[model samples]
Target: MSDSRQFQVALSLLPYVGAKTAKTLVSYCGSAEEVFSAPSSRLLKAPNVGQRIIKSIKENKSQALEEANKQLSIAEREDVKILIYTDKGYPKRLLRHEDSPYILYYKGNADLNAQKTVGIVGTRKATEYGKAMTQKIVRDLTRYNPLIISGLAYGIDIFSHKASLECGLDTVGVMANGLDKIYPPAHKNTAFDMIDQGGLLTEGCFGTMPDPSRFPQRNRVIAGLSDVLIVVEAAKKGGALITANIANYYNCEVFAVPGNLEAMASEGCNKLIRNHQAHIYTSVEDIEYILKWDLDERTTKPIKKSVGQLTMEEQIIMNKLEEDGGTMAIDSLSIKTQIPLGQLASQLLMMEMKGIVKALPGKQFKVVH
Candidate 1:
């Protein structure tokens, strides 16, 4: 609703600019609003700012802005939350990735940055085994209270969402289309329940149909939003495998439930594990151990220690947690501490071990006290 946000939404709707180019434009111009106002000569100075893109930006400025206003109006009327890349509520994990969407239209009460988040994906033609595995994994994950993310497609996707709901866990449906309509239409009731318990998320705008090409883009969001992506079952190729690969690329952990070597549903998971693309997932403990979520469920918060006794990195992270009201996303902490993600993750794990901090569900940390 702010003019700047309207501009950002408009900039995102540009014909030629996508996540990458939009990032470039924002980096060069300092903001989406500035990009639209910038002279063509100045825009050309940015890398990959060729004449074609620049022309599209200039030519579509008015139309895009008009459309953005209309889109925002619809979102407001429909109770959708429009999250820009720089917004506080934007998924911190996704923001850390290079190819994250410029804007997202979300309609949900669930925190996008829940302390523990997992993406459950698999083949659309799910097997009985796949469905059972999805239910079991989701039910087991209830102890950790993770937010479940999945594409709202048929087979495994729907099964995951329904299972999460039955287990009383919040589950988000990431759609290839806009929020205006649910894809596969049959999952309408499940989606309706999610809006209150978890909610639907999408990068697409109103009127955007579930085009086949857009599903890959949708898969990337599923990968980015999750701390770990689980492949309950998959084939040699499908949206689930695509999500696993993307999750790996983003430095998020990928887990595959191994199945019969010859079974069609298990082939993809088996290949991923055999080829070293993903870890072999047998039980909930594997996920708990890898993510270090194995902390005693009943462990009470430890008393705080003096800053003098802490390591430099630990003290810095602690101070940031204090500043952030005793909690912060891992990515936000990394940015505040000026620490590399890999190093930050390691330090946080060590801190968790020391009882100096507690890892929450959505990749967040809080001082134990």
Candidate 2:
């Protein structure tokens, strides 16, 4: 229902209120409804509460709620999901950043919190080299089944999205404008396809235009969503570089494709590497190394272990691994075995000592024959 949702959306609509201020209000007032219901005297008691913000809230409260109601109606009509910052369905990775948007309009099937996520960003003026690399990277990363994140702009962004679709990988497009209107209007078909496979996400509300300023803001979302960001190509001053910089600030691993020297598109990437802001990306192995992903199963010969001798819990772990190609991460094993991480880890260690299973990189395990 749009009951609490209207107020949550309205919190973002209030004048002079941004992500931090909105979060502060919610923290102090318990909820958006309480923030509205609280008197000016109580509002004054909230941290950083100023006369201007209070007046804006008091005067425009009804109008913001009305606007929120309209937004909810439009979202309902379009099948768009409005994620409040506090919602469990909101992207957990994005929530870690202090400047992350308090509201997200998402329309897609992709899990924003997929086990692996790779952000691909580059110049709008992508060359054949850049375009080729974008697809190459997406295709190469298929083994990990990572969710691809991009800005949905021309050149590299669109290339990544299309590549992801072709590879059957989920890819989310972070747009600078509202979901109600796809900017550039050229990639409409691809955007529509993404809605089924991956999805589109934006912090902008309905009717929000894609201004020059909003692109940098959008870049931050792409960076925040990604576990690791790959810059296929970038110019000296572009959204791609901005995204890479933001990723570095957020402590997210970043990789830059090595491009030819004396090329404008390569300048940003080369500079990023030279400045130690990003790692040099050559192959999918580079990603696997940084992320500690155990994509390839161990090829070593399995040790003989009798299945009948295994404890009930060890048998459960064995069954799950065998069900999932004889390999799984510790987190995944715990999930499938209905065991807590601490207990699962202890059991896996004992199994390893008993030669019933072998450990692999990235905290993964494989059952021995």
Candidate 3:
């Protein structure tokens, strides 16, 4: 890669140099090359340069250089792009965060920065409602063509990526480890699709597998990149909640889809809504309403309705289907409306016969208009 890029990556490996300290160092010495060449005495005089840091720099300079070189070699081998905080291509939204990484290793489409970003997060052990809601809301949001950002963990995270891809939306999966491998290897296929579709992102260097400790560290990046963070479902404690907390810290709008009060999977969502940590979103309209994102223009052309009337139950089901952009499952509608399954089936059949709705493979019903 570029010498300038190498110097910047080298700076990341310097003893005690973090994002904030690196900024000061670059400002003090004028460039990464200058900082490397500057005398210890001169470096100590730089703003916020502590004597301990200076001593580490002086004593470990060779070791630090070796480490940096190793990392660069690995990155070159993998064809990964390393973006320093100072790079123009570094995501601007992330740069605004207080603890943004000094350097990040990324692979796949670099054009992910070209689109608006939205985060979809929630519990790993998702419920049916959570799964359906995540899928439905993301399907609606994809019409806007926003980039999807989420941790690569299972449950809601995978669902988010899957739904986004299905709708032809580019998606970025933030990993808690290096891009050299996928975490929860079950998501390998999804991860592969994401590399070409959007990308994989992480601040951790090459060969660093995602340890438990790194995930909480990883959540901030997800929060920083997106303009809005939506928690589809969560328990009282889960990575999604941590991501939501980080998003709130970044001043990004936090949204939680309202869930059943009695469901174990929804406890965290209920808490978020109750404590005002997140706005209540039962549908995409709630998200658009709070963010003032216009859905009218982004929404797909409404399917045409035939010149026919409908029975009372069929009419109610049709309206619900319309509200969801013509996608609703029988079980979900039955639960939502407190209608018996047998009755709901009769209504769906009547609606389907009238051409008011169409039945999908997944037992999902969609309104024609």
Per-model root-mean-square deviation over C-alphas: 4.4, 8.2, 15.2
Candidate 2 to truth, TM: 0.80
Q: Which ten residues in a row have the lowest lDDT in candidate 2?
A: 294-303
Give the per-residue lDDT of model 2 (tens digit) for 204-305.
Answer: 999999999899889999988888899999999988988998988776889999889999999999999999988899998997876656533455454567
Q: Note the clash tally of each candidate.
A: 6, 0, 1
**Order by lDDT, highest first:** 1, 2, 3
TM-score of each: 0.84, 0.80, 0.76
**Per-residue lDDT of model 1, residues 1-369, tens digit only:** 789878999998998898889988998899999999999999999998899999999999999999999999999999999998888999988976789998899998999989889999999999999999999999999988999999989999999999999999999999999999988899999999999899999999998999999999999999999989999999998888889989877768899999998899899999999999899999999988777777655566665676788998788889899998898878888889999999999998888777788876446677887
The per-residue C-alpha lDDT of model 2 at residue 52 equals: 94
TM-score top scorer? 1
Off by over 4 Å in 2: 295-369
Residue 367 CA error for candidate 2 (Å)?
23
**Predicted candidate 3 versus true structure: per-residue lDDT over 168-207, tens digit per residue:** 8888999988888899999999999988888899988877
Where is model 1 more than 4 Å wrong at Cα?
296-369
Clashes of 2: 0
